[model samples]
Target: MPPYKEGRERMKRKHSVWMMILVALMAVSLIGCGTTQSNLENKDTAKPAGKITIGFSVSTLNNPFFVTLKDGADKAAKAAGADLVVVDAGDNTAKQISDIEDLIQKKVSVLLINPTDSAAVVSAVESANKANIPVITVDRASNGGKVVSHIASDNVKGGSMAADYILKTLGDKGNIVELQGIAGTSAARDRGQGFHNVVDGKAGVKVVASQPADFDRAKGLKVMENILQGNKNIQAVFAHNDEMALGALSAIQAAGKNNILVVGFDATDDAVKAVKDGKMAATVAQKPDLIGKTALETALKVAKGEKVAASIPVELQLITK
Candidate 1:
């Protein structure tokens, strides 16, 4: 072969080899970029695992008062961009404990509890604390536990106010039956104490029978019926809640009893209507809507590691004809 032709052929061969190497490098770079983009898209589409979950445990949903509380809480939770899970204990202590356990298993971020029994709920509160979930007590206090906050009305003063209204209406002389709420609830205990304190030294007044109606209107009616079987001369009835007071009214009217004063706690809308209609003498109004709003607000603050007061007090009003 000629020397010029051979040299030209060798140069062409080197050029082809360099071109092949560049193509291989470009192919690898494209694959790497595709893989990285896929990974980033998967990461962006995946749902975040941890969100703020709040467990709201209430004593019962049977009453309208609690229904209002739940409504207020739902509104606040939505406003704060948090999730809320509500559990009703139905005034049963065991059920309340079970509900708390369920919330813990869900790994809720916080607990807002209105205990069935203040003393019985302490262990459940401790369990929440162990899981690092802050517990906020609403409308009541846990017997003994590290609670983040307590939101409740002034029950003691409200109870005393109701008692004084009854006394003045009855001329401080009457045989009254006390219809209490769930036995161990803080509201029930404190309100009962306040009522007794006011009527203790008063003359010509007696609490003939005191019974727990479990804060249910049906139970209150039945219990009042039983009480009326022997004590038809009863002049007044003081119920711990409007439902019980309404129940007492049913029994009173059914048994042809008239001119009996009926005073109640929790000035629910129905209770106010009854007072206007001359069925109930008075009621102590505890703002349940306010309690629910405060509880949720406090829970959000706690989740954010913000400072919250130990106690948030709600006001009480007296409603009567």
Candidate 2:
């Protein structure tokens, strides 16, 4: 073979190798660009302004009813892929106020509250309003100020229902005692009014004793025991909540009085069982789960700049044997 021809062939081979390397480099760059674009598209699709956070302030998680309410809210929040931060006020109005302040500082997207006291929560609501955060009241109300919505049962009507049941069961003639809830609570006031409305003019139906039990079973028991010591002829006891009614039951049993009828509100599981066993005459059932779900939904709507009604009324169930 000739030397020049051999050298030209070698040069051609080198050029071919270089061309191959260049093509490989271009292919690698194109693949990298495609991967980057894919990642960008995935990010855009996965996050639509990220997730929302909701703050839930409950009056007391100590009660089974409130626990149910919280559970419902948590389930709904999880389904919506939203974050929920729950705080318990321990039935303290001051602590509830502080909890609301903390939620505001955290800059939560929305606020769901079950106030300890409606009047005491107004300041917190106003503060949230000033910060442009929507507030939804659940199972309670704020005394004054702007609240996006209130999700609760009609206490007045529930009270009336309870009163009617008591009257019918007693045959419109009996000596009764009233175990009220928390002093300042709307439930206590409204329910008491309802009972009074039904029993006021009825002949032979007398209110022998009345006292605030603070919606605590132990308190109710103590109050009832004291009343029984003074008035042995009490024919019935109406309690603002099941806890109080159960307490009254204990007191009545201790006094060896099995004839007195007991009516309660907030038909908790225990209350239902009591009714089933004939330990309680009747109970008014409030749907805590529905209240929680509705409050969260309303809060979301308000957060999204939608108009929500001031009050969302829930249904009541009359539970009796």
Candidate 3:
């Protein structure tokens, strides 16, 4: 072959090799870009950071009061753009403790508890405390634990008013059957103390029977029925809550007794209506909806590391026909 032809062929081969190298570099760059794009999309779709979540543990929703309370909390959470997790303990303390633990594992930003039994719920509160979640108790309080805030009505004052009304109606001297709430709860204890503080001092007045109905309407009915069997001269009834009061009212009606004055606390819708209808003598009004809404708002503030009042007392009043 000629020398010129051989030189030209070598130059052509060198050009092909350079072109192949450039093509390989371009392919690797395209693959790297695709991998980075996929990773970014996965990160975006994953759980969002810094989203506020609240947990509410209720004693029970069997009664209308707690149902109304939960409704208020739901509305407040929706308004504040926070996620809420509500657990019902069915008026059982052990169940409540477990529910709280599950909520803590979920990493909630705050916890709101309406304890079934005050003394039994302390360990649940402590666990949440260890998880670094602030706790706000509503309606009922824990006997022991660290709580950021407590929101409820002044039960002692309300109880006093109920007792005074009974005293005036019964002429300060009569046999009264007291229907109490769940034992060991703050509401039951405080309300009972306030009532006895007034009634116990009256020499002519006598407490014929005192029993716990667990703040349940059916239990109240049965207990009152049994009390009526043993005491025929009972002049009045004072229940710690409206559910029990309403239950006691049922017993009174069933026994064909109309003159017995019945008073109750927590003026729920049904209780208010009964008061209006002359079925109940009186009831202390408690704004459960306000309590629920306020609790959630306070929890949000607490999650932001803001200081809140130790006790936030809602207003109370007596409702009568």
The numbered model that scores best in TM-score is 3
List candidate 1 segments past 4 Å from native.
1-51
What TM-score, to 2 decimals, does candidate 3 have?
0.87
User: How many clashing pairs in candidate 2?
Assistant: 0
Roughly what TM-score does model 2 have, to 2 decimal places? 0.83
lDDT of 1 by residue, 47-132 (tens): 46655778999988988999899888989999978899999998788999999999999888889999989999999999998998
Question: What is the C-alpha local distance difference test score of each model?
Answer: 0.90, 0.88, 0.92
Residue-level error in angstroms, candidate 3, position 221: 0.7
For all predictions, the C-alpha RMSD in Å is 5.7, 7.1, 4.3
Q: Candidate 2: lDDT over CA atoms?
A: 0.88
Q: Tens-digit lDDT track for model 2 on 12-109?
A: 99999999999999999999999999999999867357678899999998888899899989988888888889999999999999999999999999
TM-score of each: 0.84, 0.83, 0.87
CA shift of 187, model 2, Å: 1.9
Single out the weakest 10-residue window by summed lDDT for candidate 2: 44-53
